[model samples]
Target: MTEPSTKATPTTAERIRSAFARAGGAMLAVEGLEPAESPVHHLLDDGSFAITVPVDGAVAQLVVSAGQAGVQAVLEMTDYAPLPLREPVRSLVWVRGRLRDVPASEVSALLDLIAAEDPNPALLQVNSGNGDTDRDTRYALLRLEIDSVVVADSTGAESVGLSALLGARPDPFSAMESCWLQHMESAHREVVDRLASRLPVSLRRGRVRPLGLDRYGVQLRVEGDDGDHDVRLPFARPVDDISGLSQAIRVLMGCPFLNGLRARRL
Candidate 1:
């Protein structure tokens, strides 16, 4: 079994990347244009993102025209757990960049590469004149060259640099976070209650819910009469795998001093 280590904290970029990848959809807004909500197709490692839009739609038209002038665009992605927590929104990532159409010749190769990393059936629909023109012409692919990133979550809001955003990797437990959080909420009420007991006396009066879990720590949402509070229960160390995560949880539960650390307003 691997042991947890308290060596490093997750950077803003890693957190943003994780949120971006997990988000099902995002609100894409261009300057001097209406915001359109679309499904996020893929997030490339180089900090570029691909989204699908109607070929003749307002967004597509704007992107094509603005690609020449270098128009500014923003992609807003929200991270929410599938579980029924009081406040399910875990984080928000705002990616600001210039939008442009990928070259026709490169679309297939790009989609193939994205599919190889995170396969989506929708990628198959973006054909380059090999099939029905009607079906293929209905949609277009747009790429955003990421310039700046801003993330808001329990910790707070801050602007992250492009290099940091490009270099960071998502959390090791990103894929399993939703499933584990849902399981804890559904089948482990008693465990949640026990964990809630570790909260401050003033916070104990309200309804406590498990908010999020990561390699670093567990977060709790306390719904008080005044308002809602998010508290992070830091682990003894950083976890990289399931066994290490389990040990961190045990250490958090057993040690009284290891209770919730920073309390941030959500």
Candidate 2:
């Protein structure tokens, strides 16, 4: 049987959703309001998200006033490698949309739905009868109807439509990216060095380090006396499984064509 190709691009929505899901909290900004940090309480199916804020805060008041009319807002979230390294930020996802408040009666069901999928302790505190009696009145749950989504990383930034995002799945390696990158950084110096040999002569003089890894390829950060440069080494094909990933890495290490590509990019 022929192996299926794993080199599929993640939809803008999928990338945004993945980043949002991984982010502990997001920076939220309303068109006419100040930016605030809010924890993501839940992500709905329609590319929308639920976030909590103090009921008495300016954000709550603005959202309440907007009501069904919805207020224009933007949410920015980022993914970072857990390991301590220079430029650990892996990718950034930005979401722009209409924001509105969830009614008191609907909050319970919404919270329940989110809990069923991914239970968060924060969600419990605001659940109907769990924590403070005045929790309902003290906290506000706002939904963002995503209008557009964009994701940026070492590769580049691209905009994604809501429909494409909803249909695309995140790369299989998305969850494991940090762990593998960390492992390579900590234990696989030789491998990284060998890969660096494939870079153009101009970049070889710099100190090369593994920067990022995804299903599509591996990136390296070359630090030189002059400055730093990032170069991506694309695999012969994308790999979803560990074995395939290993094979792809071997191909990248052995391929001469990459030298030309790297030279062109420089």
Candidate 3:
């Protein structure tokens, strides 16, 4: 199951772990599965994916476990062993068995099937020491560490973790993306909370108003009778312009209750 992320959810160590996970996902997107760019990522094949440590010392591991559809595809690809997922929801799956038996030619259908099951799941191939240099190989997998995140809700439970792939290491952009998200999770909470506190009770939705990062600053979805309104907010002042939040930044600055609030640098 996936878990929710809170203003103060995981510890510092966890943030680093989260960063590693985010990095792996980013890398897989760039290297393994470069689908037409969308809001989400996807992996497109069945192959072995491994993790490696960079000069940064911090590292993590992931396996492309199979899914229900993947189990079937593997069987079709190579006539492999008995396939059974007693309960898919409770376990992780990958394409390892199919990887060993099936050649790249037959793996495409299975990869496409898994992609259909989760169109946006991250997938990628890497160029690490253990990686295969063959330019034509591919694989499909679900990332282990990041499949869960908590939603802002009373249930206080984790969300279902999506499948992701981990291929090679990261590039400059990938590393920066990882660092950016990590920094935001660690530092942006106080800014959003303190700013949110100033708005009228009407502004806050249910007990669970998710933390949204946007172009203005931090946009809030004001749920109401018809639908929801997106209110742009500004970063807490003496602001930290770590990321571009667009118009969301301006509205928060104008909130009457938050007039005196200044963005604090982390």
Q: Which of the numbered candidates is closest to the native, going by highest lDDT? A: 1
**What is the alpha-carbon lDDT for the whole of candidate 1?**
0.74
lDDT of 2 by residue, 1-266 (tens): 11123455445566666676567767788776778766654667877888776666788789888769988888888787556646678788878888898888888989878888767666654534345646544556788888887889765788987777767666776666767766767776667887888788888897887766767777788778776677777777667887777777767778533322110111
**Candidate 1 structure, TM-score to reference:** 0.85
Q: For each candidate, how many residue pairs have backbone atoms clashing (under 3 Å)?
A: 0, 1, 49
The lDDT values for all models are 0.74, 0.71, 0.30
Q: Which stretches of candidate 1 lie over 4 Å from their true place?
A: 1-9, 132-138, 255-266
Q: Is 1 or 3 the stronger prediction by TM-score?
A: 1
| Best of the two (1, 2) by TM-score | 1
Listing every candidate in turn, what is its Cα RMSD in Å to the true structure after a full C-alpha superposition?
A: 6.6, 7.8, 16.1
Work out the TM-score per prediction: 0.85, 0.78, 0.26
lDDT of 1 by residue, 49-80 (tens): 88776666788887777666656788898999
Arranged by lDDT with the best first, the candidates are: 1, 2, 3
Tell me which residue pairs clash in candidate 1.
none
Worst 10 residues of 2 by lDDT: 257-266
lDDT score for candidate 2 against the true structure: 0.71
The candidate with the higher TM-score, 2 or 3, is 2
Clashes of 2: 1
